[model samples]
Every structure is written in structure tokens, then in C-alpha cells.
Target: MELKGIHHVSAITANAAGNFEFYTKTLGMRLIKKTVNQDDVSVYHLFYGDDIGTPGTELTFFELPRAARTHEGNNSISEISLRTASDAALEYWKKRFQEENVEHGEIEIRYNRKALPFRDFEGQRLVLISEENENGESGTPWKKSPVPAEFSILGLGPVYLTVPDLEPTHKVLTDLLGFRREGSYLSKNYGQSEIVVYASGKGGPGTEIHLEERKDLQRERLGRGGVHHVAFRTADQAELQEWIKKIENTNFINSGLVDRYYFKSLYFREPNGILFELATDGPGFTADEDLSQLGESLALPPFLEQRRSEIEGKLKPLETKVKEQ
Candidate 1:
């Protein structure tokens, strides 16, 4: 079963409004959707990405305002990467961060890729990598943000995962899924060798998956400030079902077809203890809301319509506004 690429990456954040400001104003991604978490209506499930909020372009967050800070450890996702047009775009980002007084680390090279690492308002580590090998769907420009037409984000870059042992995780990524070993490196921070995996073709945004081996580091707890799950894309429902069978046959428990409103999802955890999802690509976020008013209001799945008023009252109000640097 061949996988197309990443569908979306979800994480937990501390403040919804702060995250909104950072992602939309600081990072220049469009606030594509503002909704509530299906399971927990008290929290906001905010999504930020390219215009039109394409499937693979989404970076979602669950806001838990009072949650405690989580320590970054071996069993957690280390960083989220976004791909830009070139190294020159990264330079532009550096200048933008400086102008905003947001402290960013120096640009670094890993696994032969150039990346600039920075943090959001909630301390979620994010990287901007300049790689143009993979083709991206063209979308409308986010006119409100500082991002210009040419250098806007292509989409999500490699989702970084860490584990205690590298072999089992590597096997799941290469054998079960179709990612190939791109390169390996010794981390200056963790001081252990990390292997980076990329899709079969020359990888770009949402293609590379980084795995770090840290035997001594403790396992991480999933809560605020942690990645929820990493989803890989499939061409359609048939392909998704095929991979579902493939994953179930491998002795992993996979959730059967789940209607995510826009896309269908099948979820399973890999051998390395990382949660992975296989998602379909059609029936997107615009299925209900018109493209013009997509992220401006609370959008819910059809089944939840009867409870809309209660859900809306439970969630905190989040207003989207452009902030000056």
C-alpha cells in the first residue's frame, strides 16, 4: 500500500488566541478554520495553513489554557517543519522575526537540509526549511499576512519523531509505509545519531520524517504542548482501505473508517509508540462553508448540528486580527 504524503499534523497548545496571533501574524499562515474539538467542546480546535486550507497544508492545534508545561523528551515530537521556496526566503523570515523582536536560533543544517528553528508563543518548536523538490497545490495568497506571493509556505515539512529504539520505528516507516532513508546525523543537543526518512521520490514539504534514538531519555506524556498525531495522505478511499488492511495485518490495531467530515481516517500507532493516521484527500474543509468565510465561524460536522448552540457556548471566543510587528 503506497501512501501519497502527509495529510495534517495536530498539536496541543496553551493559548488559542496567542497561537492565533503567532501563526497568522508572526508566521504568516492563514487561519483557515476555527472550530471546537469534537470530543471536548470546551477547547478550541484552531487550524492554520495555506489559503483554502488544503488537507496537507493544515497545522491544527487544541487549546488547553490552564494545562501545565510539558518537558520535551525522547518519546515526543521534537519539531514541526514547514518548507519555503529557497534559502533566501529563510533569510527573509529571519529579518521578519528580528523586526518582531521574536528571538530565533541561528540557521542550521541537518541531514543536508537547511532549516531555521523557532518557537511559537506556546513554545512549540517549528522549523522553516527551504526545499523545492516536491510540487505543491497552488492556492490564494494570504493578503493580510506579511508573506508575499512567491515565498509563502509550500506546506508542512518533515514531522520529527523521537523514540527509544530506532530499528522498530525505522522498519515501520520504510517497510510498512514507503519512506526511504534520506540521511542520518549526530544531534548536537541530544548527542545521539538520528536518522531522517523521506518519501520514495525526491522529498520536499511533508515528505521527510525524522527519527531520533534516545535510549536514556524518558518517555513523554501527551498533553498540552505535545503533538497529537501525524497523518499521512492517500489518493482516495480505496487506497486508504488498502492501507488499513495492510496495517491491521501487521498486528497493529487500526481504527476502522472514521468520518472526519472532509476526509476519512484510519488510525494506528507504530511500533516505536508514535501515533500515525492514514487519511483520504477529498471532501475538504470547504464542503460546508463557502471558501470566503471558511475560518471566520464555528463549523461542525453534520452529526453535531443539533448540539451547535451548546458547543458554541462552551468554547472560548477567538477573534482573528492582524498584529503589527
Candidate 2:
């Protein structure tokens, strides 16, 4: 089966209130879901995206009130890139970052695409890449977003993961996951070894995954502001099930079939141990809530209905409004 693109990338944050304000007010993404982690109901699982939380545009977080700071190292998702509508849009973000005094890197070129590396308040590594994609379309902007729709973020671009060795992960990507090896690029950003890129599906801006070699770095210490897993998109349930069947028979381990309420998911790990998930595209953010009322209230899956009151009472109220100190 053909993978469409990235489904969603999940990460962690120690501060729920801070994370909610950063992504919504500072970044202008719409909070499409307000729910608790199904496995751990005391903490929150927040979903942010374009107007209605489109699949490709999703960036989710699990609020960990006291998780340690994430240690940057090999075998972890290093950076996540988001698609910018145009070079003009990139400039808008630069000015906004400066005005807000947000920590950001200077604009640089990688793989012929212009990118600005930046970090959230929690120091989650992120980048905005400005490239010309004629086939790409910007997602619907939040009605109350400060950034205009023309300059709104389109969706997820390529994701970067640092691995100790390339050959093993490369084999899993190309041979097993059906990714096509594109060319490699070298820059001072990485060291002597060049970063290899593997393209999935039709391979547009949001369909690329870059693997960087960083053997000297230490193993990632899982905690707040670190990516939990990267998910690739399957068109629907049938294709997702096909992947589950393929993974179960392989040397790689898998989570089998899972019902995530919004989508069907099968989780597994690449050889390097960076968590990977295959998620379907159907029954999306609108499954339970309507477009107009999206993210207004807490949403619970069927299994968690009985404990809604308990969960809601435990979760801190996540206010999107930015309060001046």
C-alpha cells in the first residue's frame, strides 16, 4: 500500500498551560481536541492543527507536569519542519518571532529549501521551511488566528531523526517501508557525514524524512518537550491493516491494530528504536465534534465515557488566551 504522508507527530511538555498558550496564541494553530491521555487519564493529550485539526497538520502533545527536560541525542526525533506558504510567509514568522522574543535560529538553506530553526518555550525543536510546492495547499486557518490565512502554515514538512548508524535504518525505510532513497546532502550543521533523505508516497514537501548520522551523541533521555513518535499516513483502514500484517511477520515488533477514536493506528519501532506509527486518515477530528464546536469541550472515546467526570476534574483548565505577565 502507498503511504500518503505524515499523519501526526506526538511530543511531550511539562507545562500544560504554557504549551497551550504557545501553540495557540503564539503560533496561531487551532486547538482541535481537549482530551486526556487514554492510558493515563490524569494527564492531558492536546491536539493542535489547522482550522479543524487536519491529519497532516496535526501536532499533538501529552502534558507531563513533572517530566524531566529532554536530552538531545542520537536515535531520537531531532527536529520537525512545518511547511510555509511562501518566502513572504517565512519573513512574517521571522518578524513575529523577534517581536515575541522567541528563541530562533538564523535562516539557512538545506536540501535547496530555506528554513528557520526555532524552539518552543519548552524548547521543542521545530523549523519552518519555505519551498515552492504547486501541489500543496495551506490548511484552513483558525478564524481568530493573528496570522493571515495566506501566510498560514500548510502542514507538516519533513521530519529529522538522528541515528547512530545509517545502513540498518536505511534498509528498514527503503526495503520495508517502501521509501525511495533520494540524494544525500552535507553541511556544517551535521558533521562529516551527510544527511540522507528518504521520500514517501508522491514525495512533496510534507512527505520526506531525513536521517542524520550522529554516532557521538548520547542516547535520548525521554521526558518533556521530546518527540514520542512519528506517524506516517495510510489512506484508510484497509491500507493500515495491510501494514499491520506486514509488520507482524517481520523481525520488527508492532502494537497490532489500535482504535485511537479519531483514526486507526499500528505502532512499531524502526531498527534504531525511534518509535514509529502507521495511522489511517479516516474518521478524523470531526468524528465526534462538529466543525463549529471543535475543541470547545473535552472529548472522550467510548471506553472512557464512564470516567469523564473524574478525568475532567483532574485535568487543569487549559486556557488558550494569552495573559500578559
Candidate 3:
């Protein structure tokens, strides 16, 4: 099946409010949705991204207050990439970070792309880079964000996954999902070997997937600040359905046709234990709210209407405003 690009990335966070502030006020993403975790309805499942929170632009978080601080080892998400338009946008971001007193490392080149590495409120590594893509499409303008329309993120970059073995996981990405081997590298700090894979496209942050080799680290526990899943986008519902058939033909169990409010999703696990999802891009976050006021309040899927009050009550309130001293 032909794929369009990434759909969204879901990560866990210890403090929902803090994560919301960092992504919206600091990183300049629009808080596009406020909802509850489907499985664990007690916590808030907040989403941040471009206006209307288009498929590829979404970065979701699950709030868990009592989860332990996870050590950054080889088996966790090393980093996530976000794409920018040009070198000028990169420079603008550099200056913006400086003015905000957000510590960031020097701009550097990796795999021939320029990237700026930094941490979020919970130390989850993130990078913003200017990688040109020929077929890449720009996201909807979020007028409320401080970032100008010209500099809004195109989409989520490939999520980095650290695994003990590469061959098995690589098989799932390439053989099953049609990703090609782009390059490989070694990291001194984490003492891990790495491989980079690219989907067929003009390569950019969201297009390149990185796999790290950490043969000795223990498996990760899913909690706050952990990644829940990485979703890839298909051209349309027909294309997504074809992928569902392909997955079933391969003898892998898949959660078929689950309605995720905005998009229909199919969920399954790759070989390395990372949850992978295939999601459709139509009827997006804007379906509920006006494009202007998305992410401004709590939005629920129609099926969950009866439980809205209970869900809201269980979630800790989240706000984008800075706290008064």
C-alpha cells in the first residue's frame, strides 16, 4: 500500500500542564485538543500541533502523575524530529530559544540535514531542522501561535527507537512497511550503534526514521513521558484498508478500523515491541471546532459524550498561561 507520510506521535508525560505549556508557549505549537486517555480515562490525553491539529502535526501526551523518572537508555525514545521551511526559519528559532532562556546545543549537521537539539519540560529530546522535501506539504497556519505561518512545522519527523537488535526490527520497517535503509552511525554517549531509514520521499525530519542499537539495556516500562505509539499516514481510507489486508495476510494481529474521533486508526506492533499505527488523514481535528478555535477547550468524540463530565473531572486542569510569581 502507498503511504502519504506520518500521521501523529503519542508520548507520555509526568505533568500534563507543564508539557502543555512547553509545547504551546515555548515551542509555539497550538494546543489542538483536550481529551482523556481512552484506556485510562482518569488522566488527560493532550494533543499539541498546528491549527486544527492535522494528522502529521499532532504530538499527544498522556498525563500520569506518579510515574517514576525513566533513565535515558538505549531502549527508550532518543529523540523526535520536527521539520522547518528553510535556513532562515532555523535561525529565527535559534534566536527565539535564546530570548526565552531555553538552553539548546549548537546547530549541527547530521545525515546532511541541519538540526538543533533540545529537551522538553521532561527532558524528552527533540530537534527542529531545515530539511528540504520535494513532495512535502505545509501545515495549516496557526494564527494564534507566535510562530509565523512561513515557519510552522510541516509535520512530525521520524521517531527514534532504541532496540537491542536491528535485523528483526529493520525487517518489519523495510520488508513490511516499505522503508529503505538510508544510512548508519554510532553514538558515543549512549554507546550504541544506529541505523537510519527513510520512506520514499524527499527526505526530511519527518521522513527519516532512526534506530539505535542498545543490546544490553532492559526493556522499557510504559508510563508518563514514554512513547505510546508512532502512526504513519496513508494516502486515503482505501490505501489504509489495503495495508490492513497486508498486515492480516502476514499473520499479525491488528486492531481494525478503530475510530479515533478525527481519523480511523489501525494498530499493531512492530518486531521491536514498539506500537505502530496506520491512520487516515480525513475528517481531522477541525471537524469539531472552527479552524480558529481548535485546541481551545475540551473536545470529545460523539460516542464519549455521556462520560464527558466524569472524564473532565478526573483530569487535572491544563493551561497555557505562565504562572504568576
Candidate 4:
């Protein structure tokens, strides 16, 4: 019962409309699903991914209109990495960011790969990594993306987590979650501490997590621009059930076998307090909408269909129209 790569990383955004614009128009990813957070029907939970909203490619956000800016520190999902075609793609993004007035760092190598770190308008940390020699699952870019298909953002790469200490989190990853220790890399910023790497099934950038140990920082105060949780992919309900039993065996408090409609999930926090989710890959975004019409309108799951009127009345209308190329 090995877990696949990342399923999705859910983050917080204060402006649903602005977040929608940045992710779809700026990043050129397809808005695969337009829905509200299941736990809180009043706010939007938007999902962006490749053409068909493939499991590992999804990057989601939960909108909280009045959320405070994130106070960054340790014990957080520090940075998110998006994969692109090659080092030339990094060049394209660097030039694009400059032209768009997007804040970004110069392209540099990190962990033997070219990367360009940048922040969204909300100050959400993100990096684009060149997938020149990377392995694991390849991403399917949206053909109609504003950026050319060859240079478009493909999928999630290695997720970075910063914690005060590493031992506890390391144990949870290597022992409890079945991730293999893939060695460590020296951090250019954090003093003396080496960033450790862990890989799940098919071990590659797509399935890896880069963990940074930082004793110099405080616990993160999460709000807008902060990552809510990162989910790993499981094959189906049966494997998810196995993971549920496995997690239940441990002392970690977990939400067992949650039917997310699009996917089944189990949520828990690692030792460092970073939320982790194990999600199934089946019954995907296509369950409710046609491929061509995804994200064109708000979608609700069966149970929530009855409350659609109440939910729609609360959320501010978000324009999901895409400009024709």
C-alpha cells in the first residue's frame, strides 16, 4: 500500500476573485473546479490544475475574505514548487515575472535543479522548478494556457516544510507514513542545518518533500497566504481504508475516511504540526462537469446540492470566464 505523489496542496487566500485571476490568468493553469470549502460553505475553495485536473497536479485555495496576512516562521508548509518543462522555462518565467511586475528572485539551482522562487500578489511563496532530469509522473499542460504548452506550469514538485526540530517529523515521515529518506542537502539560507529529503512512491521531485529544520524561527501564524495542508495521493478507497487503519493504529488524531466526493481523504498533523492528507485519485473533477466546461460555474456535491441556494447567496459572484487565445 504505497502512496503516490502529492494529491493537492490547499492554501488560504483572502481574495477569491484576485486569487482566481492570479492562478488562472497569471500562472496559466486551468481552474478545474469552482466550489466552496465543504466544511465552510460560505467561502470559496478553488482548485487549479492541468487540463483535466489530474490528481497530483491540483493546487487549491480556501478563500477567507478577511484573513490576516501570514506571519511566516517554522512549523509550516514553507514553500510550494511547480514543475515546468526545462531550464529555459525558468528563463521564460523570470522574464514574464519582470514584465508582469511580479516579485521574483533570479533563477538559481536548488537541489541540483534550476529554480525560480517567487511570491504571488498575496505573498504566497512559490517556486518554479525545471524538470530537466526529474522523474516520476509527467504533467499534462492545458493546451489553451496563456503560456505556451512547452513552458507552462505542469504539476506539483517537492513541497518544502520548515520545522523547529527534525527528529519527530522525520520519524512520522519515514516510519508512520512510509516515505523513504532520500538524503539531505545543505541549506543556503538556514545556518548549519541541512534540508532533508523524503520520497513516497516512485521517488522523484513530484513525490518528494524537502524538510528544513530551523530552530531560529517561531511557530507560524497561519492566515491568508499560508498553506492549509498538503495531501498525498492514494490509489483508491481500498488503499485509503488501509491508510485509515494504519493511521488509527497510531496515537495521532485523524479524520478517518472522509468522502470528499471528488476524492476520499484522511487528515492528520505530523509531529511538526503540518497538516497532512491522504487522498484517493478516483471519482475526480469530471464527476460533476464535462471536460470542456470545468470551472465555468460553481459545482456542489450531492449532499451539498440542496444547500446550493443558501451557499450561492453567501459567496460573492466570481467571474470564471477565460479569454480566448
The model with the greatest TM-score is 4
Spell out the clash pairs found in candidate 4.
none
Q: Write the per-residue lDDT of candidate 2 for residues 171-199, one digit (tens) a residue.
A: 88888889999877875575657888888
TM-score of 1: 0.92
TM-score to native of every candidate shown: 0.92, 0.96, 0.89, 0.98
Tens-digit lDDT track of model 3 for 203-292: 445655788778888887666556778888876778878888899988677898788878888999776778889888877878887776
Q: Model 1 segments beyond 4 Å from truth?
A: 132-140, 200-202, 321-325
Each model's C-alpha lDDT?
0.78, 0.85, 0.75, 0.92
Query: How well does model 4 score by local distance difference test?
Result: 0.92
Write candidate 1's Cα lDDT for 185-218 as tens digits. Answer: 7676666565656663335556668887888888
What lDDT tens digits, residue by residue, belong to model 4 across residues 151-247?
A: 9988999999999989999999889888999888887766757999999998888899999989899899999999999999999999999999999
Q: After superposition, how far is residue 157 of candidate 3 from its true place, in Å?
A: 1.8
**Pick by TM-score: 2 or 4, better one:** 4
Could you tell me which 10 consecutive residues in candidate 1 have the lowest summed lDDT? 132-141
Question: Candidate 1's C-alpha lDDT?
Answer: 0.78
Q: Over 4 Å off in model 4, which ranges?
A: none
